[model samples]
Structure formats: C-alpha cells, structure tokens
Target: MFVAEAAGLDAIAATGTLRVPRTIAHGISGEQGYLVLEYLELGSRGKADLLGERLAALHRCTADQFGFAGDNFIGTTLQPNARTNDWVGFWRRHRLGFQLRLAARNGYGGRLQSLGEQLLGALPAFFAGYSPQPSLLHGDLWSGNHGFLADGTPAIFDPAAYYGDRECDLAMTELFGGFPESFYAAYRAIWPLDPGYATRRDLYNLYHILNHANLFSGGYTTQAEQMMQKLLIAHS
Candidate 1:
C-alpha cells in the first residue's frame, strides 16, 4: 500500500499541474509497510479558484488508455487499474462492478446487487455520444483530500491516482460537502464539461459511495442502492 501510494504521488507530481506532497520514501519496516512524505502546513482555506484552475490543468494530462500502471487502494479497499481502451467497460468492470462484487462477498445482496446489475447494463446509454479521453485523476478526491499550503497555494494529497475520465475527479469533489463555488466556476471556465455531465455525475459518484458501502456496510449500502436505482431510472 505504501509503495502504491508513492507511485500515485509520483504520477500526480509528474503532471506538474498541481502540488502534491513529495514522496520521500516508502518501504516495509519489519512487517509493516511505511511511506514517508514531505510535510506541508495545510489550512482549510486558500485559493479556491486557483485550485479549480490547476485541477482543470491536471485533467488536461491524458493517456491513450484508461487506468494506471498498477492497482491501488481507495480507503483500504483494493482498487483495480487495468488499462483499457473502453471507458465504459473500465468503469463497469473495475470500478462499480468490482465494488458490487465485493459487496456481495461481504454479504450485501438482493436489491443492492439487482440494482447494481441493472445500472451496469445501462452504462452504455450514459455515454452514447461521449468518448472521454483518459485524463489524469486524483482517484479518491474528496473535500478532505485537499487544502492550502501556508503560502496560500492549493495542495492535494492522499491520492488514489489513475488515468480516467476527468469528470470522475470533478464528481468526487461534489460528493461530500463539496468545494467552493469558485472552484466549480473556475474549472468550467477553463474546460467546460460536456452537456451530458449532469446525468453522468451521479454515475461517476456511485463508484465511490459503493466503495464506501463495501468498506463500511451500513447506511452506505442503502445510499448505493438508492444511487443505482436513480441511475437506472435516469438512463432507462
């Protein structure tokens, strides 16, 4: 896990789009894997607009295919990052499908699995005309993952980095409490999202909530089910 995190930090740092804590070192100490990162004094508030613009710039970094060189973790859950040419197939097979299968393994079945299958089948409808370039992503981007350096520069950390649809990052920013309005406005100002993004946002976010359900089975399972049902209805 430490090694994967170092790789992810390196991937994000390579883009030169945003500031990431430098991965000083990573290795196993005895039976425990350890990662050392450069410390940055972080504050909750900073340049929200700049954060948005730089994040958009980060999204501009793209790959020929979706996924990363290796798999990583999303909050302790193993996240697969097998490269593929098809974005929809990647999401279905690795993101949502993987989580749903894990959920089933963890004994969450019946309605949840049923809705998940339906949502998986209807995935293509959401991307009928949209073919997304595999842009660099901060895979587990949530409000808690970002902050400002003491210099007022926006810095992001704890990445589950991969190359996928840029909107995946944007969708995650909106998942919890959300970033400031300036962040969204600035991002759109630089690279306006597709007209179909509103409908697909929930689809992208479903992967995370499902991950949450798999990681901590309680209200998140219901949330995932509700999200799946809504997605199925939206695209059906």
Candidate 2:
C-alpha cells in the first residue's frame, strides 16, 4: 500500500505542476504498510488559479494506454490498474466493474447492483465521440487530499493516481467544493475540456460513490443508484 502511494507521489511530481511530497522511505512493518514522506509545514490555501493551472498541466501527462504498470488501492479498496489500450474497457472492467462486483460480494444488492450493471452495459454510449488518450490523474482529488505549504506552494497528497480521463480529477474537485471559480477559469485557459464533460462527470464520479458505498455505507449506495438512473435516462 505504502509503496504504491510513493509511486503515485513520484508520478505526480514528475509532472512538475503541483507540489508533491518527496517519499523518503517506504516499507512494511509487521502486517502494516508505511510510507515516510518529507514533511511540509502546511499553511492556508494557496492561489486557486495556480492550483487549477498546475492541475491542468499535470493532467496533460499522458500514457500509451490506460492503467498503471500494476494495481493500487483507492482508500482501502483494491484498484486494479492493469494496462489496456481501450479507455472505456479500462474504466468498465478495472473501475466500475471491480467496484460494483466488490459491492455485490459484500451483500449490497437489488437496485444499486442492477442499476450499476445497466450503466456498465451502456458505457459505450457515454464515449460515443470521445476518444480520450490516457492522462495522468490524481484519481482521488477530494478537498482533503490537497493543501498548501507554508511557502504557499500547492501540494496534493494521498492520490489514487492513474493514467485515464483527466475529467475524473476535475469531477472529484467539484464533489466537495474546496475549488474556486479562479481554479476552473485557469484550467480552462490552459486545457479546455470537451463539451460532454458535464454529462459524463456523474458517470466518472459514480465509481467513487460506489466505492464509498462499499467502504463506509452512508447514503452512497442510494446516491450511486440516483446518478445511474439519471445517466440511463439520458442514454435512453
């Protein structure tokens, strides 16, 4: 777990867009995984525009295909990132399919499971005209995953990093609302997203929501169902 985290940090830092903590050491300590990182004295929020622009540049980091060289974890859940040339295939199998299957095995059944299966079947329609090349992403970019150093450098940590749709990162930014208008504005100025992002955002986010449902069991299962319902309606 810690090793994968260090690798993700290195990948993001390679982009030289946002700040990433240097992984000093990583190892396993008697049934526990640990990653030691260079501690940064975090301060208040940094410039939103800079964060947005840097994140956009980071997303420009590309790959020959979707997925990492190996599997990693998103939170405690195992995230398989085995390489695939087909973007939708990667998202369907390694992403939504993996999460939904896990959820089902954990006894989450009925409507949420059914709706997720339907959405998985309809995945092709979501990418009808979109042929997205794999882009490096801070796969879990919620509000808590980012901050600023005392020197005002924007640092994002605890990434579930992958080479996939850039919108996945942007979609998670909107999930919890730490990002500001200047952030979106700066990002658009650098790499403008496709017009279909607004429609596809929910589809991307549903993976996270499904994972959350399996992990924490809040109202997330319901949320996933609702999102899929809307998506299925649109596709229909």
Alpha-carbon lDDT of model 1: 0.92
lDDT of each: 0.92, 0.89
Give the alpha carbon lDDT tens digit for every residue of 42-62 in model 2: 765778788888998898889
Find the candidate with the highest lDDT and give its number: 1
Query: How close to the true structure is residue 16 of candidate 2, measured as C-alpha lDDT?
Result: 81
Q: List pairs with backbone clashes in candidate 1.
A: none
Model 2 scores a C-alpha lDDT of: 0.89
TM-score of each: 0.98, 0.97
Using TM-score as the measure, the top candidate is 1
Rate residue 211 of model 2 by lDDT.
92
